[model samples]
Target: MSTSSIKFYDRFSKLYPIVDVFLRPQKRRLFEEINLLDHGKLLEIGVGNGTHLGLYKKHALIGIDTSKSMLSKAIDYATQEMQLLHMSGEQLEFEDHCFDYIVLSHVIAVVEHPEKMLEECCRVLKKDGSLILLNHFTPNNFLGYIDRAFQLFSPIFHFKSAFYLKDLKALKKIELKEQIHFSRLRYFKLLIYKKP
Candidate 1:
């Protein structure tokens, strides 16, 4: 990530809860996209303010983030069973094939080296594990052109990334389990991939 991006998150972390209130509906859709009880050793990347903590409270989870203020809120929101870490998703500090499930909420796109981060995600995931990614994906048509055009203004928005499934380079080992659209306009998508 760039220095400016880090600074932006640091400053926004203070008001993340309020910001998250507006995202509750999307967050709820993300939670509904997966069946949590079926998995174990869950690792949530970009666990901002731990807004999704309640969903994973009963499961063994480790949530990671780069923002200190966001992590502080995670610590306060987390249960004794949950663990929170101050780290970047691009460089995960975990053993290979250690986690049964890897969860990402609007994270894969914004990171500096999304391909590298996906590689790391694949490395830590067990052979039978599943990867759940929830984010906005370009539609591969006219709307996609608009999303691609937005990349020119990425530094300004600092929220959206022009990430498409076709752009993922280190994903030959996983099979696409499903792709579900979360928005009426078909901008947001939920992708489920499982290692065979």
Candidate 2:
């Protein structure tokens, strides 16, 4: 990760709660269908402020982020089973197939090389494990065109406004199991992939 991107998240850490409110309903809906009770250790990449940490009560949560400022705030939400680490997802320090599930909520588009991070996610995920992704993927319509136009400001926001799933090479290594378009305008997409 770049220093500028880390700095941007450091500044946004305080306001992230308010920003996360808009996506709460979407996240709730997505998590409802998934069964985490039987799962083992859960790793949430880019677990900002740990706002959604409570949802994974059944499993041990290992939340990782690149910003110290964000991790510091997330510490307040930490539980006995939760460990918040200030680390990058692109280079995860874990053995192969260590986790039964992984959550990459709203992370793909932000990282400088999303594909590399995804490869790491797959590397550490056990076979048959689910990789849940929630983000604003580009819609194939007028909204997508507008989204692409807004890419100019991504450097400032530290997120990709025009991110597409096809651009991620690691996707080919896994099978997409489910897709939930919860947003009214279909702006956000929740994808669940199973590593076979």
Tell me model 1's lDDT, rounded to 2 decimals. Answer: 0.80
| lDDT tens readout by residue for model 2, 22-88 | 9899778766855543758889899998877777657778999999999998888888778888889
Report lDDT per candidate.
0.80, 0.87
Model 2: residues >4 Å from true position, as ranges?
Answer: none
Deviation in angstroms for 188 in model 2? Answer: 0.8
Report the C-alpha lDDT of model 1 over 4-83, residue by residue, as the tens digit: 77777778888877868877787787677655547579899989888668866345899998877778877878888888
Q: Name the top lDDT candidate.
A: 2
What pairs collide in candidate 1? none
C-alpha lDDT of residue 196 in model 1: 84
- TM-score of candidate 2 versus the correct structure, residues matched by position: 0.95
TM-scores for the candidates = 0.90, 0.95
Question: Candidate 1, TM-score vs. the true structure?
Answer: 0.90
- In angstroms, the error of model 1 at 15 is 3.3
